[model samples]
Structures are given as C-alpha cells and as structure tokens.
Target: MENGNGLKIMEKNGLSLNLKLQNGTKVDNGTHWCFRGNKELDTPPEITIRGVLGMLKDSLDPSDPRPTIPLGHGDPSYFPCFRTAEVAEKSIADALHSANFNCYAPTAGLPSARRAVAEHLSADLPYKLIADDVFITVGCTQAIEVALCALARPGANILLPRPGFPIYEARAVYSHLEIRFFDLLPEKGWDVDLNAIEALADENTVAMVIINPGNPCGNVFTYEHLEKVAETARKLGILVISDEVYDHITFGSKPFVPMGVFASIVPVLTLGSISKRWIVPGWRIGWLATNDPNGILKKTRVVDCIKGYLNISVDPTTFNQGALPHILEKTKEDFFQNIINTLEHTSEICYQKLKEIDCITCPHKAEGSMFVMVKLNLGLLEDIKDDMDFCFKLAKEESVIVLPGIVVGLKNWLRISFAIDPCSLEDALGRIKVFCQRHSKQK
Candidate 1:
C-alpha cells in the first residue's frame, strides 16, 4: 500500500514501527505495522554532534553574547591546551601539498593509510599484523557501523555494553540485528560482568562490543578483568569488538590494556583513532584492525564482508589518509607526555572538587577519557527533578552545560569533561559547586 507521501507500507511481527512521515501507531504482540500513508520522516532524537550543538545554542541566554561553556560536547577544540600536535599539523600540510593525494582514493581507503595504521597499532601486539588486515575508516564510529553491517545475520544477536556508545546500538538496530546488553559493574571499577555475558549468549550470538577505558564510566579495566572478558567471549564463540578510541588517555592507577593482546586466544576487532590522542576530533581518521591471529575472522569470511561493505561506503578524506605515516612517526614523545600530564592534573582537580559538592557524587575519577561520569544525588537537592532537568536548569541558571547521564543511557548521572584548560575547569567546578549549594535541601 502506498501512502500520500509514497512510502511503502510494511508490517513486522505485530508492532507498528513507523517508517516515513508517521510513527508506529500500534504494536500488537511484538510486531510493528507501518502506516499506509506517505508521511514525512520523523526527526530522530538529537544524537549527532551538530544536533547537540544546536540544542545547546537554543538553550543559551540571549542577553549574554559570550560563548557558553561547552562541557556537554566531547570535542577538545574549545581548550587551547588541547590544540593539535605540531607534527600532526605538519604531516597533514605535507599531504595537502602532495599532488598524488588530490585524487579520490579507494572506497576502502588508501593502502598506505591502512599500512601505516597497521604498523602504528601493531606496536602493542605480541604478533605482527599485515596491512591486509587493516581497514581505514572516517572515524571509529564508521568502523562500528561497518562491523555491525558485516556481522548482521538472521537470528544472530550482538551483545553491547549498556550505557555504551549509542552509535553501536543505533547501527545494529538499523541493520535489523538483535541487541543484547550486558552490565558494566560500576562497583568493580567498570569491569564487564562475565557471568552476565555468558547468560546473554547462545549459538545465535555473533559478537560482543566493549569500550576500553569506558566512555561514560570513566574507568579503565585491569588486565585480569580483560582476560576474563576474552575467555567468556571465547567460550561463547563470539568475536570481540574493542572500542579503544580513548586507549592511552589514562591517569588512573590501572594501565590501559588493549584487547588485541588476547588475539591469540580469541578473535578481536580493535577500533581506534588519533582523534582523542591528538585532540583532533575534526580530523575524522580512524582504523579498524583485525587482531585474529588464528584467522577466525578470515575463515568466517567476515573480513571479505567488511571490505565489500566499505567498497560501497564513504571513506576518510584522501589528504588525511596520505598524512597517516608522518603523523604517526613525527609526533614527538614530549607532546604526548605533556597531554597526559595535563589530563592527570585536571582529573585530580575535578575529582577532589566534586567531593565537596553536596548533591553530586563521582564513582571514580576519570582514569582515561576526556570525561568523568558523576552521579547526581537528586535526594540531596530540592530544585533538581532528574538528570535532564538538572542539566537544563543548570544551563539556564549557571550558563554551564554538562551532559546528562541519560544521554549516555545512564539515568540520574552526569558526564562532565575535564579536558578544558585548568583554570576554566576550576571555574566550571566553582559554578557547579554554587549550583549544587543553591539547590541543596538545607536552603
């Protein structure tokens, strides 16, 4: 049946999942039946980088022209201390000057880029990887997209970490893949619950996704914890998709351990990018490396499926691809050391100050990523209703913007970024303290 807008009508088991202009009107028995009219596409929740920025802009006070503090967004460009590495800049400049890179590269990405990424990532591995096992992506997000597309098979489900990157869940949902979520035990320093994973898996399970140095949790996993996760995945015959975009940016007592270290034991698909390390979110260059030493992925033809999907997909810019080798090679050790040192100092400041606030509690100081996840003790405040309410009111009242935990799938919690300049971070913390005290029940 055709609707007024020319959208084809479709029905699923019993639920009516809206497609074009109209939303699912009804779901009978677990099945979706699309409306029979051509309707306009509905606006999805503000999930994209640009959409959130727009929301933040709309929430700003018109009387004030000064830029709003953007702790809500992940990009570090707002901080002068996080400026791109000089060698990264020079490498990209050189690539722009190289006339050979002006042409449209392969859809799967340039061979040299893949080779450079393979070499750069292979440093932490016990086994060497060939360039053929590497695939260059526009960013780690696309790598997750491609992986989900390739792994989609009927009746097969993928396990994802709850409060995980929604892109993984979004991509899987769009591809008609079933999603099974396992818990990250926050009490145990954000380690995966191996028992939960085992219970979630069956013969139909294909892969499990884990974000090392977790995104919202802000806790890095110990080697023993990672080993158990690998063992559990191996026992279930599922591949591991390791999201390591924040791989080395840690200030915690525990070290960041890459899941690729266990490749010999079980197949692993490691996704990483220089965006976080170099503070170049706009660069949009990332890599997906297959760490299957036993060739499990190759034997299953997963590698070919990934390449086939990439052939028809968009790729990273040619110039950025051309700059990979020099960016990897010429970036000085001092630059990385300095960035880590700064992150360490800022994390300490954020952590210590958060403790003094009566209404907010941080589970752990962010050990790795650019952000920290803190629980909002709603019981302690009279004005705050919930996480979103808290953030909305805080933005209006303080002109400070912080991500609500609901955005990351954790309700009543907030994710705050401490990646800004030290003074600004302290200032923001001061604003937060004032907000908490103002809303405190005693007042």
Candidate 2:
C-alpha cells in the first residue's frame, strides 16, 4: 500500500512494515543523522598512530618466522617485564566479585572513585583537591575531549606544541577550533618555545596544552620550566590543560612536576589516568581535575561546561571505578620503582644502540615516557625518501613496526618506543640497525 509521504509501504505477516520511497521522493533528514553525510569526517587530515602502524603491519611478510617487533606506540602490557602490579589485578577482581557495583556509574563517576582520584593526585599537589573537583572519564583521551569541548567556542583558538601528540590536533579539528603551533626545541631537550607561544596567542586564544614528561620526546620539565609555563598562561589570561598521563613514570635527574602545582597562578585542567603508570590501558579509568584553588574555572563556567559534557557522554565502567580506591592506595611503592628501573635500563639500551646507527640521531635521552623522538638522516640513506618511507621499508624487510614522525606533526623524524622487555627492545633495535646499514648510501 502507498503511504502519504513514502511511495510504498509493505507489511508482512508477524513482521515490521517496510517503507520504500521513489528515487526523487523528499524525506525528512533530521539534524541528528545529517552528520553521517559529512564527508570531512570521513577523511580527516590528521593521521593516527594506530592507523599508520596498522598499515605497516599489513606490509609484513607472512612467510617470515621472526616474531613481529612493534616499536610503534606506547603499550607495554604484552611483555612479561611490563606486567601490571598484582595489587591492581586483585583490586579489580575483588570489585567484580563484590556484587556491589553492577549498575551504571554516575556521569561524574562514583563518589568513592572520585574521592580516591582526588586524594591520590592531591598527595603531590600543594593544595588539597575535593571529590567535586575531580570528574572521572572513560580514559585520558575522553578527558582531553571534554577539556577541548569545554574550551571550544566561536572565534576561539588553542595553542599546541609541534612535534607533539596528534590527538590534540585531531580533537581541535573535529571541534572546529583554530589551532596554532608552538615549537618544542629538540636541541634544548624538547622545551617549549615561549616566544612562539606568545606570538601565537591573541585575544581569542582560550587555552594552551602542555604534555609534561613529554610524549614522543620523553623529556621531563623541571620545576622552573613549569613555573614559567604557568606565568605565561597567566599573562595571556588563558587556561592551561596539562596532560600528565605519564606522571611518576620519570627515570631521570629531574622529578616530574605537576602543572597543578601552579594552579593558583593560573586556572588549570589536569588530565591524567592510571593507564601508563599502572600498566592498565585497557581498564579505561581516567580523570580530569579542576586544579583552581581560587575557583577561577568555576567562576568562568568552564567547570560547569565540563560537567555538562560528562552528563551526556558515556561514563567509565562502574566495577572498574569501584576498584580504584584499592588500586590507588594499596599498590606498593616497590612496584612503581621496578617499572621505572626497567624503563631506565631499556631507554639506555635504546639510546646507545640508536647512537650507533649512522642514519638516526636521538637528540636527547628518554627520561620519562616510553618514546624517544629521533631525527632521521635521510641524506645518509640511499633508498629511503622520508620517515614514512623508512618505516614502511623497515617493517617490510625486518617485520619491525615503528611510528613515523609525520603522524605527530614532524616530518623526517621517528618516534621509538622502548617500553618493551629489555631483550625484545635490544633485538628490535638490532634489526633496525641492520636495516639502516643495508640501506646506507655508503653501502
């Protein structure tokens, strides 16, 4: 039978009616479904690490007997040496068995979970944080999303670090926020270029993001440098979104300084998670804490906006949130020390091996995060064209995967992850050295 709007409607016995329309029929395409037709989202300019690495994985020879070595990204859970703490495992198991937290978690997270996160982070901060100041997220990625969404506005722009993590750039693009790049001087141990940041900011600049214990570069900022960053944000009258996902993972002379320490100097939003430190990225528990002691964020309605976003977005798993208190409080200090010790040893091995490779130059030793950003000497190689070409060739020849720097806003550089087992990391670096030697121009 024909309907008033649709050309035809057919009803089958005990089945739902099927509506079929003529080719030229005009139908209501609601705003909710309109985004599906947006071609811009189908092909974003930003390339994700996973997307690039997956492409390399596909190029590997199936007949090769050697196990594929992945030096591409920063997940170390597959290696035995990087096993998560037993206390963390027990905490989650206990939570699951308790039969107390099967329901959906509150949008801002369970009160107990929020309180635990606040207290855990406050231990390192100058001022204490209350549960209300902390909002649990699905993970640090969502925390970043919420922070960017809260700050995004028409005619507003945000400052980002070049040779930095691409997630910030991806989110900025998706949110339609204008992005301005500030340089991180690789020669100066990846420190932020304050002059460039100053030049990038205008009256419309709403926020700036800083990744301490830096991603890809693995350079931890000193206390003095952090203070300067806070001062700069204050001078610009802009908020600071500090990504501290790698907190306490430092294995260097300088201690990890939380930007929250200078929250009183400037309004700050600190995004963090137990993923890196606890070795539980799959657990997906993270938080965004408003670190303003003077209530600047609250007064500016930023906090309200964050809460509003959380209200509509999906919450973290309830049982996982239930496990947080025990995981944060009971995990022994020795466990953390062991992780730092292993990373320090592996980083040293990676640095020494890369130093031997004539086609690669690591500017600074990795001190905190799992990665080291090394400049690729393409001029020294006969065949390789750029970082992407080098990575593709490396993967095909040796079944070794690495992330090209172009994905992270830098071309002709490579990001190497050394968080795997020391033996595996050594073998992987050996394969890389062999591959580079085979393709050297002098060869």
Candidate 3:
C-alpha cells in the first residue's frame, strides 16, 4: 500500500506493517506499525469492574503522599483484617505436599470436589444433589460465562437486572446474546420489578439473572420475593440464573435463601464460589450447578452444552480440587461469622458516611455483599459532569477509587465497596464527603 509520502507500506493480516521498498530495505519514514483490536472485546473494558478499577488506579496522583483507598471493586483479601481461615490454607498445603494431584484435572473437574460442592450446597436445598448436578469452574466468573454460552442461540435474548453485574452483558454481547434489562426497585429493598419482567420477555427470551445478597446493591432477596421470581420464570417458560456467589454472608433481617430452593418449581442454574464466603477469591474454586429437580436442564440438553463448553475450557487446579472437601467440611462457623461481622461494621460505616455527603444518595443498606450502590446527585456538584467524571476526579484528587454506576447499567450513580478495614472505610468516605463539599454549588 502507498502512503501520502509516496513510500510503500507492507501489510500483514489486514494491519499495516513497517514501510519497505522494492529492494526489501526498511524505510525510515517513522510510520509506526499498528494493529486493530477485536471489536467484540470493546464492550468489556468500558463496563467491567476490573477495567474501571484499573482506569481509576491510573488516575491516581503520584505526588500524593497518602495511600490509595480502593473502594471500587470488591476484593477484600488485600486487607489484613479479612484473611481466609487457617484450615483452608492448611488444606491446600496438605494437598500440594501429598504430590498426588500433580497431574491435570478432568475438564469438568475432579469428582471429589464436585461431590463436595454438591453436598455443601445441598444443605440449603429441598432435595439432594448428586455429583452429576455440579460442574466445577475456575471461579464464579467462568461459571457465568459458560452459563451464558450454553443459553446463547440464534435470535435469542436474556433478561438482566438494572444496576446489575456488567460481566453478564459483556459475555452476552460477546456471544451475540441480546440483553433486556428489568429494574430492581431500590425503593423496595431492590426487589425485582416483576411487571417490567412480564413486559420485557417474549418467545425469544431464555432466562433471567438474579444475584441474591446482591453484588452492587447488597440487598438480600426475601423468600417470598424469590418465590415470585420463580413463579414469573415459570410463567414465562424461562429459567432462572441465580448468582449466589455471596451466599450465606448475610447480615440482614431477611435470611439468605438459595434459589435452588425453588428448583422444583423452575429450573435454576445456581452459580456459587468460595471467593466471598471464604474470602479466597484468588483460590478460584467455583461451581455451576443445574438445580433442576425435574431434570429439565438435562432434558433440554443444557447440561450437555455446559459440559461441552467446559471440555474446551481450563479447569481449576488439581490440588485445590483435592483440598476442597477438607476446606468445606473443616472450616469452622466462627471464621464465617467473623467475615459477616466485619462486613456489617463496614456496611454501617458506609451508610452513615454516605448520608453525610449531599451529592451521594444510598437507597438501601448493604446487608450481604461488600458493595452498596449510591446515586450521584450531579446537580449538587459545580463541576462534576457525571458519575465517571466524579470518580475520575475523586481518584485524582483524593486517591480514592469508586466505580461508575453506568458500567452496571445505572447512570448518574456510583457503586462503592465497604469491604475494606473499618478505619480505611471511614477515611475513604470522609474524603469523599470533603470532595463533595469542595465541589458543592454553595461553595
């Protein structure tokens, strides 16, 4: 190809290579070689939690002496206060030292780990779960991706929650699965907008996703609410993709109810992980269970599809799998309760401190998960244009990172993680309050 300067540019795989002449000598015109990025991956960077967190971290001021307070994403393992149980660490060590799990694990995962997860989750269910019902995943992240792939079809769509996890949309869009959002009523403890679901679904809709003890909202769904959800899915002839990654970490009045409880009413694909409850996200042990008591998933070939996908995918470590039974069976209740108590402390701190800021409005208290979604009153701030602007400026000036709510399908809002130390949580919110005051219209 010829450029404006009349030098020939070589091409490879539809991208411009370095300039060269007929004699094969590289031209010195200083035109750098470049390539295009995948169009499918563009949506993920703008919406994913990790992408936003990385952007916020880059906006930090190098000259600032204070430490960066990360309130953006919900990985609390960074804090010393939220370490995993000793038994969990010991289990992995013992498995590794045994040298029995050095080889690659089965693509679907080791049978023992699968059975352990099945039995562990079965405790909360109305019926028993066999090992075949569960497919171990690298993490809940992979579980969601594989689940979406299994459901994706030509001219198909899925219903999602507003202010929901962006990974659902990212993976869906990547797989060419259409997305239809139904709001979660913040006014009613972020309950599913059943009317909206009824209106949005059609023959092409396959399933609806529900994150109980939610991610950004952190409001646990009541048994009655989940029952209504099951009824709605049944009426629509669709399944429920229940994301219970934050299971049993609840500190709210309403108890944590497994969507598997309603597997008899409708097919529920329940996704869970050791990430949140055990505070070991880096451990990367998770499961995707077909909680259909009637065998609808197997009948529909959905379980087969999931297995096919996992066949080509990477498995969690063999040693981790070998240790999972001990980890699940031996970990004491105190370790779990300690996490809940710490989260409760930080949640209260987030609620009270967010109240002190005029520009931020938190609709519901965080009762389960590490995050709480708050609406941004952009009108109250003199210079802040939107949630992204507020977060970027906050990161640059205060060294505090927060997530823009638009990434999670809500505009003019922010999602904050209260999963850090209590002191750090208070300090970060205090900085946010000062930032708001400094940028206030009255100021």
Candidate 4:
C-alpha cells in the first residue's frame, strides 16, 4: 500500500495494517480498524421481505386506473366485513374518558389489563395464570422481539419455522442470535417436521418459536401435534414460544389448539394479540403470557429476565390496555361469526381459482389466518424466472401484489392474502388467472 507521499508502506513496520483509499491513496489505519460496529452486516439475513417488493414500487404508473390489490399484509380493517366491531370502538372511547389511564403504566404492564388478559386466556388452559404472568406489549411483534432479545446469549441459538413469519428472523438477527430453521412439512398439511427440528437443536438452543394457525401456511396445529412440540422442547431443554396471533380464525377440518395446554410439561411463552380475532390490529394491544405451570421458567429466572427487559420497553397505550376485557367480551357473536365466514368464503375462492391457473398450485387450502402459501411451477410459466421475478411480473402485468414465498424462506412459492373484500378478492384472482394464462408455457 502507498502512503500520500507515494512511499510504499511496509506491512509489518507500519503503525497499522493495510489502510488506503480505493485509489491506493494514504489513509489513517484508525479509520480502518474503527471497532464496535457489526461486521457481519453484509451477510444476507436468513429471511426478509425487501427484495420481494422492490420492483413493485418502481414499475407502477400513477395514472393507471387499476388499484393495487394487497395480498401481502394480514390486516383486513380496510375491508368492510373485517372492520372492528362497533362495541369495541365504544369501549375504547369509554376507556379514553377515564383520567386514571393518563399516567405511564407499569413496565410489566397496567395491572388491570394484565389481569384481564390472564383471565381471558386462562379460560382454555388447565392451570390458571395471574396478572404477574401476563406482560402487555406494543403488539405481538414486540412480544416476539422481547422474547428473542431476552433469551439471546453468546453462542446461543433459536429454532424457527421455515415457511414462517420473517419478523422472528429480523429480531433474531438484530439481537445477533444464531438461527436454525426447521421445516413444516407441507406434504402432511403443514405439520412440523419433528425430525428436522431435532436435527437443528443442541445445547446452544434457548428456544423454538411455533406459530399455531400458522402465518403464511394458515393451517392450525392439532392438540396432538402441539403435545409433540412441547415434548420435543422439553427433551431439548429449551423453551417454546407459541405465537397464537391467529387463534380462532379456522374454517378447515381441524380446530386451533392452544400450545399453553401442554405448558405443564414444558415452559411456554405465548404471544398473542387482539389484532386478528377482534379485527382491531391498528389498536395494537397484545400480550405475552408465560405458561410454566411446572415453574421451569420461574426457576430458570427466564420470567425475571423478561420483566427486566420490559422495564426498558414501551407498553401498549394505556387506553388500549383498558379496553381489553370489553373487546374480548362485548364484540358480538355475530361479528365474530361474520368475519370467519368472510375469510372462509374468500379462501375458498382463492383455492378454487388457483387450482385452475395452469402454472400455480396450492399445496393446501388455508384453514386459518388470512393467507395461503402456494407453489409456483416455473416450468409452466414462460417469462417469469423465480418467485421474486414471478411476483414482480405478476404485479406489473396484473396489478396484483401477493407476497413472494421467498420472503418467508421458501423459494418458488408465494403467500397470498384473501382477507380483502369479496369483490376485490375476486378481482385479484381474476387478474392472477389472466396473468398466468398469458405467460403460460402453453402460450
């Protein structure tokens, strides 16, 4: 390396190592060895959604009359059928009237709100939980972030679902935690591949995240499957973080099973929100419920670790916290039933339509949640290259915006949200069919 004086700098005798500009100009080695920033940053994240939607933002014309059909986000509040219940709105308004909620809430959460979540969730568990076991978070997203941050340690690892939510991966990466992915076998209607999880875990693994009524795949776990998950986590000597954010939206053959039911055998951290069930995602109230009936989490001080972390975290708005019980109880039965019916009908339309698209295949009809994960057969499409390319082309050619499955760590597959209004869902599917047919290999 040459210094500014055009003197050749010796490797060993120089004050520091090779330090020079790209033009071989002299630079202080201090800039080169500036310590304490993440060095592993350039490494691609194990999963993310960035590249999936990159091209969509650039290609769309402002004057185009066709609206963007969003099947990428899970929220359906924009759809009439899935809007928040009127009673929920009134309860939140009522809570706002109380000056008592104006102060900063306790770090763990507001006491009354925690108690309400505990009582509501405990209705399904064999063992009851107290307010101390419930921690209010900004939303389920933060609940997962806190759990991952709390459990992360040097050389520590965590297991995640392959075709799962990417927020887990994002938080894990930010916390510098190593991640090992386990597959949910689509062949078996999206059951967890136990052997794969067993292969991934060792002493370093601190926890495994399981999504019930899964995110991208949308199939609910059976009690038997959840029992096996609990047993596996127990054997691996790690905790289970069950994300039940989509708890009761099932319309398939199997019902949604709460993993907390098996908490007696293994410590479980349950993450949930009022987002899906109550159709109030923007309200952003969620809870992190610790279910360790055997007290393993308490014994290990994991519970305390979570509390310490929460002390530095933000709580859900105090007003939203106060609205918990009312939202849980007062949301009418008819409102709940109508949302489920809308989801089911929309999912059926997607399923039937995708089957007819020559280039695409749905492995399983979505039974819960708002999305379905489908495999795109590249061999059947003429111009598209892969999932990302296919989605880019689909968005450009058809004005439809479905998520590329590669965002969820699965390639050549896509997760489509059918949670929009029925007519919009119909339009999106029609566009998808037209796009596929126009690009078909047969064409």
Candidate 5:
C-alpha cells in the first residue's frame, strides 16, 4: 500500500508508517536532511590561501625522499634560524609558574596588557594612547575580523588593494560588506593607485584597508604616500584600517612607517601583533588600537561597536596577556636586530637566486615582509598551464611548496616566502630553477 504522494505506507493499530528507498534522490523523511543540501557552508573557490596550498599538498608524492620545503607561508619558527627571543619565552614561563593569570581576562583585555600594548604602539606615534584605546585579540586575524565587523553596515562598501591579502576579502565577504578593489601599481614599486581609490569611493564607502610593508608584495610605503592615503580617506569621510602586523621588518632602504602616524589627518585603526616580530605566531596575542587623537572613532560610536563585539568574543590566552608587559619592556634590541639581519640575508639570497631563473621575473626585491611576488613566465614553460598547475608540478616534482598568485588575486604570478633558513631558501630556489629549466620550451 502507498500513502499520499506515492510513499510506501504500512499501518498497524491505527499507526501509519511511510518508507522510502535511500537512493540518490531527495527524500523527505519528515525533515530535509541531506549531506550535500546545505550550499551555505560550501567554500568559494580561491577564497583561502591555506585551502589552495592544502589541496596542492595532498597531491604531493608519498615516495618523495626529500623533506617538503615550505616556501609557501611566512612561518619559519620551525627553522632554528628563526627562533623567538629567550626573554619572550622566559616571560611566558614565568607567568605560567606564578599561577596568577589562569582565569578569564576582561572583555577588551587585561588592563596591564592593554596598557603595555598602548605604550609600545604610542612610542611610534606623535600622540599618546591609553589602555582604553587598545583591545587585545587572539591574533591579527581576529583583530581584522573585529575591525571589519565594527565597520560593516547595510549598503556600505569598503576599499581593498588588488593582489592583496586574501583574509581581508574573506572577512569582508563574510561580514556582508561590499568590497571594491583598488590596484597596487607594480610598475611603481606596488604603490596604491590613488586615482583608482578616489574613483572607487562613494558616500557609502565606510573604510579602506592598507597593509603596509605589504603582505604578498613585500613593498613598504613611504611617508609621503601614506600621507596621501590618509588625505584620501579624510576626503572620502571614511576610516582607515592599517594592517601593520609586519611592523619594522624592513630590509631595504625604506624604513617601515606606521599608517597611524597620519591619524591626526584621518581616523585610523592600527592592527598589530607580536607574531611576526617576535617569531611566535602561536602565542595568539595581538591588538587593535584606535589612533584617532581627535576622538573621531569614538564620536562615531565605532569604538562602542568594537567593545560590544569584544564583550561577546573570546579574549586571548590570559597567561600570554600576562607576559606582554615583560615582552615589551625587557626584550633586548639586539634580538630584534638579529631577526632583521637574518631576514635581510635570506631575502637577498632568494632574490639573487630568483634572478638567475629564466622563467621567472621579480618586479621588485623584497623590502619589508617575508614574501616576494614574482611574475611567472608561463610561455617559457611548455607543459605548465597556469599558476595553479605550476605550483602543483613544482610540489610533486621538486618537493617544494610555494603560494600561487591566483590565491592573492593575481594570475601568472607567485608569492614566495624567503623567511626560511638561509640554506633552505637557497636550496628551494635552486630546485625551482631546475624545475623551470626542465619544463622550459627551449628544450
């Protein structure tokens, strides 16, 4: 027998049962339950750099003897050459031993930790910052999320750089903020195309993000250029979110300039962390500071939004927060200098090695951050299809890992991390050269 709608039915003692075969067709068993039904959870293509790299890693040969050289991301703590300072490690150990900070931290952060971050960041700016202006986050990643959430409103838009960090795009999309892209002119040392930025902004544009000592490009902005960006934001009546997570890691002639220096001209949200500088990304301690000496952010209630969000969000690890004061106050300058020196040496080696490869061209030598964006000469390689194909082939054949530029919104280019040990970096580049030579069309 069959019930309504041709469902097979059975009845006993006035109870009816409807059964359907578990075929590949959609079956409503009093609920629409299917593993593939929810499209909302599906990840969009090219949305995350990690996801793309993970796919390439899965395709790597199991029989390969050489250890995988990760030139993909900016993590180098695994290498002995990039270890964190002893003082930072000692501070965390001391905090743990004291047993004073195991409890939950305050919503914004621990008062002492916030104050320490304020003081540390204030040292670089003309104006001073109080603890109230600093909010501790899990890492710069959360700092970015909180900032975007605070700024996003219905029918509002934001400006981002092209060939930029994918996190900004991912967060903006998740927050329902309309994103408009402006170009970073590669021919001009990857400077922000100010004219495009001006054209992209409308009255509905809420904010613009600038990643100084840029993430994928490794180009640092000069003070004059930052001044123009500030001016542009002020004229647009929009806020500036300065991602300075890689602060002061410069190797080239241009010194690292914090976008907060121009906060007097426009309201700026400065995001920073000890991750890159201290070489301890796993610590999960970072801050978002409002650099508005004029109280513009407070006046607009953007500060209130951030606090409200933080009130419901998880704070960074308490013991790590307890260690911040010591980390900021006692870490020797020589420790920082050593990191810069090592990065400078590794970057030069990578650049010189890359220059010798006939199929790749580096537009500019890496100046600040741990990455360099190089244009891949796909035409010179007969078998490789695109950046994705190139990366897969390189990983499978050479046991090397590098980020495809398509993940960063630039096709036919590559973002290489030179932050590994100098010897490993040299070896990886050499392997890349060999791979390119092996696939060269000339042969």
Candidate 6:
C-alpha cells in the first residue's frame, strides 16, 4: 500500500537510508542525520583564472567611462570577428528541429559521434581507432577530470607542466592525485625541461601532460620536439596526456603535431575539443581518446576504468552530439584558416605592443594559441608589488585586464590574451603603456 501522497516507501535490508518528511521537516529514527561534505579533501588556493578575473572585475569602478578591455581570459566569443562558422550554427539548428535527438545519449557517447571523432583524429595517426577507444565529455575540462581520476590510484602521482593551465592542477587536486611540476623553459620558447621530469618520476608516476599550442604561453611544439616528448614518456614508463584543444591553428615555424602520432612509442591519452578550433566553446563538446596502438591501455584495464568513470558522469548534450558530425565534416578549411589568420595578426600586434612598455617584456612572440606569457619587471614600476598588484591596478586605473602569472604557477609574470580584434588589442595595449608609465619609478 502507498502513502496518501502517492509515495511508495522502499527498504534495503530493513533500512531505507532515506528520511521521511512530515510538515516540511525530516522525521528521523530517534536522531537526525548529519549530512556533511567530505572534509578530507584539500582545497586549493583560490587563485583560479575565473576567481582572479572576478576579483579584478570587482576592483573596477563603475564611474569609469572607458570600456573594460578583457585580455585576462581566452574566451573570444564576445568578439564579432571570432564568431563561429555559419555551418556550425546551422548544424545545431538542424539537429534540434530533426526531432530524432531529443532522447538521452548513451553514457559513453552516441556511437556515430564517437566514430566521427575517431575518424577525425585517425586522419593524423597511423593506426585507426575504434569507437570503444573514444569517450565523449562535456568539454575538455571534464576529459581532464576523467583522465586524472582514472590515473588517481593509491599514492599515484601525475606530472604537470608549470606555468600551465590551472584546470589540470585543480582537477588533480580534487581527484586526490599527487602532482609534480615540470618546468617549461621560457627562454627556450617554453619547451619542457625533460631532465626535471626524469628526476620527478618514480614507479608511482602514472602520466605526464602537455598542452600543444600551449595555453598561457602561445608556443607551438614542433614535430621533432613532440617525438622527443613521446620518447621521454616511453623511457620513463609512463603514458602521455596531450591536450590538443588548439590543434591545427599554427602560425609559427612549427606545425601542430598530435601526440597520437607517437603512440607507437608509448600509450597516449588525448584530450581535445571543438571549442577552440570551431570557436564554439559554449556548445561544450569534447572527447578523450586512448591512443594505445600497442593495446597497453586495454591490457592494463585503463580503458575499462575510463569507461567505468564515464558510465557515472555527465555527458555532452545529445543534440550537440547529433550536430557534431556536421560541425566536424561540413565546416570547411577556409573557416579554420580565417581564424588562424586573425590569431596570427592579433598575436603579432600583442608581441609588438608589449615591447613598447618598459616594465613588461614578452620573451617569445606568440605563434598559435590565443595568449602570450610576459614577465613583469617590478623594479621599473613605482607602487606595484607584483603581478597581481599590476593586474588589479590596471583594471582599476586603465580599465584593461590581464592574468597574473602566479595564477598559473609562475610569479612576476602576466598572461595576456591577444584573441580580440586588432583595434581593441591596440587600444588595450596603449592603455597598458600609459598605466605603466604612470607608475614608473622614473616618474
């Protein structure tokens, strides 16, 4: 018999584990349950990109007449020039109206969507990938979490790139995985210090991660360099996690090479998304692929572990998955090249403009990605304490924004995004120059 409210009370071994409610108050078994969050988890310092950007925005005065120039983050969707391709928008509309994709997607992914991602990635790889080798994620962020959690066994540690994307560090911390930092040499165009990685790894080391056409630093890895990275991971007896979100957008002397190209040497876990290339981050479609041509991931049960994690996790929207095939196939090369050309022009403008400021120095010219990491010469400034101070002051005084390098594990530097229109970039840079001069020690 059901209750008067049409509810059916269930029991598990004489205990429901669910509290009954009466008059909006929970009725307990002579004692109320105290549900609390896990207190054992380590909370990271609240210097995340979003957190810091929020603080900087809060520091701004509303009375200021100038428009806020956002160079702090990499989202370019607000800019008219960086709008996504027309075909991509049409694909989403078509998928929504088709009435065939309103149903729930499989936990792993829609089979055809998985196959399309595999085929797209396999075009650059020697060995083909089956649908089982790919798992769709809400975005690359979720893919990062899945990869980290899968590798987060007891006492297992993961190596991360320094001055890197903060999301990896955040996810690793949340997954309770030990993190070891491997420096990317800014003097060498931000190449990884392989020697440091050698000293950091042991039997417990699970994987090493690299972001190509890197975030924070806009250096693209050469084919030779990537080959060496794969070899190093092989020698260390660890798999490589390559993030190719900025794939094929190179405008440098080097080309964008996928780590899967070297899967023959070692196993690789690749995280990628259409957010960067297609310029539709809001759509939130990404994937994780196990590029284990040697079948090591399968032999070691890593693939099974990843699948298990996906079975209980959130997935990309089904309609987005339905539209993904068209987004990947129908989108022409010309659309991609146009964005590349725009980034090339904007990156050039960023590199040159930073050179004009006395206190800020960009060590390397940006090549592929949307940002450039530059050092802050605090001695040249009068009142600023560090990178954070510089950013806060710039936001308040000049109405321009930039990211503090300390937010990405480096101090006394800044991460400036050049993905805006050329005129806005120039205007923002000019304001930065003025702000620097205003605070100059000589002044």
Off by over 4 Å in 4: 1-47, 50-55
* lDDT, candidates in the order shown: 0.83, 0.91, 0.92, 0.85, 0.91, 0.89
> Residue 254 of model 1: what lDDT?
86
Residues 1-443 of candidate 5 have per-residue lDDT tens digits of 86556566567679665455344334453553354533433576555888988877887888999889999998889899899999999999999999999999998999999999999998988888999999999999999999999998999999999889998988888888999999999999999999998999999999999998899999999999999999999999998999999999998999988998999999999999999999999898999999998999998999999999899898899999999999999999999999999999999998899989999999899899899999998889988999989999999999999999989989999999999998888889999999999999975
| Tens-digit lDDT string for candidate 1 (279-373) | 89889999898999899999999999999999899989999999988898878888988999998998899999999898888876688888888
Q: Score candidate 1 by TM-score against the native.
A: 0.89
How would the candidate models be sorted by TM-score, starting from the highest? 5, 3, 2, 6, 4, 1
What is the Cα-based lDDT of residue 318 in candidate 6? 96
- Candidate 2: which stretches are off by over 4 Å? 1-36, 44-46
* TM-scores of the candidates in the order shown: 0.89, 0.92, 0.92, 0.90, 0.93, 0.91
For candidate 2, give the lDDT of residue 125. Answer: 94
Model with the higher lDDT, candidate 1 or 6? 6
Off by over 4 Å in 6: 1-45
Alpha carbon deviation, residue 43, candidate 6 (Å) = 4.6
What is the RMSD, in Å, between candidate 3 and the native fold over all Cα? 4.5
Q: Please give the lDDT score for candidate 5.
A: 0.91
Model 6 error, position 174 (Å):
1.3
List pairs with backbone clashes in candidate 5.
Answer: none
Clash counts per candidate, in order, are 13, 0, 0, 0, 0, 0
Compared with the true structure, what per-residue lDDT tens digits does model 3 show for residues 207-300?
Answer: 9999998988999999999999999999999999999999998997989999999988999999999998999999999999999989899899
- Lowest summed lDDT window (length 10), candidate 5: 21-30
Model 4, clash count?
Answer: 0
Stretches of candidate 3 exceeding 4 Å from the true structure: 1-37
User: Tens digits of per-residue lDDT for model 6 on 190-306?
Assistant: 999989999999999999999998998998988888889988999999999999999897898888889999999989999999998988888899999999988999898888889
Candidate 5 displacement at residue 244 in angstroms: 0.4
